[model samples]
Target: MTKKLRNAPAYIFLTIFAVFSVFPLYFMMVSATNTSQEVLGSKLLPGTNLLENFNNLVAQQDLGSALYHSAVNAILTTVLSLIFCSFAGYGFEIYHSKGKDRLMAVLLLAMMIPFAATMIPLFQLFAQNGLINSTAAVILPTISTPFLILLFRQASRNFPHEILEAARLDGLSEIAIFARIYLPTMRATYAAAAVITFMAAWNNFLWPKVILVDSAYQTMPMLISNFSSGYVTDYGALMLAVLIASLPAMVIFLVLQRAFAEGITGAIK
Candidate 1:
């Protein structure tokens, strides 16, 4: 009981923080169900206009297309990042040499530099490569995130090196060892990386906005932005778009959360 009392403050702080995080989601749901007028009327309660808002949002010019592009970009980015980051991380960790260690240091340093400083150069490079105004432009830069590599490296540290030796005893080559042994054995690490990578790709805004100039290439985030403008912004429609944009990520997290939670635990053994 005395120990529990000592931890009471931590529990209180966590409860407060949880409420703070949840309030906005509640607010968004309520706001999405009401009209711009009702929202401005300062009602935080849900209304019956949810269906109407959905209709209006879907009715927005090229909304379905925008949502499709955003979904596609996110899926492609996450998939590629998982494959590349996982391989690179496992390789760098399991196959350490002075040269590769220096290369890893370079990659870590690159993560320190803000993408904003490189935006112009990145855009120019994409243009030069004929990738601008395409999904490739949006995905190419994001698919190789340094942050994801670090995450995988940390998880890989938990793997048993003896497992590698055992696999080698079975006459497995380096590539075969990773594919048949390491990858299959590290499901949790993959899950955690996938969740983070998927969320990052889905929520990315600046690069998508910069390169995807046309409505065909625009995402749900851009759609929400356009909806938030001018004399009479449809708060309900805007909220719906925001709501829609958040769903894919939510679904992903909810579905994979168990795997994500377990992934790190398994890796440590």
Candidate 2:
């Protein structure tokens, strides 16, 4: 009884925080089912306009193509990033050397350079190569992020070198060792990386906006921008589109929440 009383304040604070965090999502969902006036009026109750809003969004926009482009960009980025970043991280930590440490420092320094400074050069290069408005253009710039590399490098510190050595002595190739041993051992870390990478790729806007010059290559973020860009925006359809756009990232994070927590804390298991 006494312990429960002592913990009451913490529980109360947590409950309040959770409500605050969740309220926006709830409001978004509610607004998706309401008209523009009701939404502006801040109606908290769910309305009957969900199907109408969805139909209007689909009829007015190429929602299917946007979803496809976003999914392709996000999945390819996440998979490629995991493979490359994990390899870089594994090599850096497992084969520790002075040269590698220096290189890692340089890479970290590169992170400090703002993307805005590099965007113009990147655009010029891509234009010279005639790769504008392609999925490759969108996916290329993001495949191996410094942050992901740093994340994997930090996680690799917890990997057991004994297993690596034993596998090598047993005549396992380096690739085989990584594939069979290190990969399996770092499942939680990989899940965390996937969640982060997928969310970033899915929500990426500025680069995609600059690179994907064609309307056919539009992503969900771009679609949302189009929906809200007009002088007379349909708030119901806009909210519905936002709800749909938000679902993928939300589902991925919720599914991987536990692994994400564990991985962030460097829990080996």
Candidate 3:
């Protein structure tokens, strides 16, 4: 009884924190079901306007194309990032040469340079190549990040070298060993990377906005931005759009959260 009493304050604090953390999401959902006026009035409960908001959103925006574009860009970026970064990471750790270490240091240094600093040059290069407004332009800059490479490299440190030797002795090619052994062994790491890469790619707005000049290639973020852009913004429909846009990343994280935790903690197996 005494111990329970001692922990009561802590529990109360935690409950309050949890409520505060969840309230934004709850408000977003509730606002989605409200009229624009009601949403502006900060109505906290679900209302009867969800269907109306959906109708308005559909009428006003090209939701389908936005969803398709965002999905393709994010999925491609995540897939390519995983493949390229994982290979780079595996090589860096397994090979372990002084030259590679210096190269890695250079890559790590590159991460310090903000994306904003490089956007103009990237835009110019893409323009010169006639690649502006293309999916390739949207995806190319993000498919291999220093951060992802570092993540995979760190994860690779936990992989067993003896397994590699055994696989090699068994006449497996390097690619075969990576495909058959290292990949399965690092499932958690991959899950974590996939979640991270997918979320980043999905939420990316600035680069895509700059690169995809054509409105037809608008992504979900751009669509959401357009919703909130005008003199007469439909707050309810805007909330609904945001709610929909947020779903994929949330789902990916929830599904991989356990593995994400394990991978972040460098847990092998």
The candidate scoring highest on TM-score is 3
Candidate 1 achieves a global lDDT of: 0.84
Q: Where does the lowest 10-residue lDDT sum fall in candidate 2?
A: 260-269
Q: Could you tell me which 10 consecutive residues in candidate 3 have the lowest summed lDDT?
A: 260-269
lDDT of 2 by residue, 1-269 (tens): 99999999999999999999999999999999999889989999999999999999999899999999999999999999999999999999999999999999999999999999999999999999999998888999999888888888889998989998899999999999999999999898999999999999999999999999998999999999988999988899999999999999999999999999988788332
Indicate which candidate wins on lDDT: 3
Q: Model 1, stretches more than 4 Å misplaced?
A: 1-13, 264-269
lDDT of 3 at 188: 85
After superposition, candidate 3 runs with Cα above 4 Å error: 267-269
Candidate order by TM-score, decreasing, is 3, 2, 1
User: 133 in model 1: Cα distance from truth in Å?
Assistant: 2.1
Off by over 4 Å in 2: 267-269
TM-score for each predicted model, relative to the true structure: 0.91, 0.97, 0.98
Q: What's model 2's overall lDDT? A: 0.93
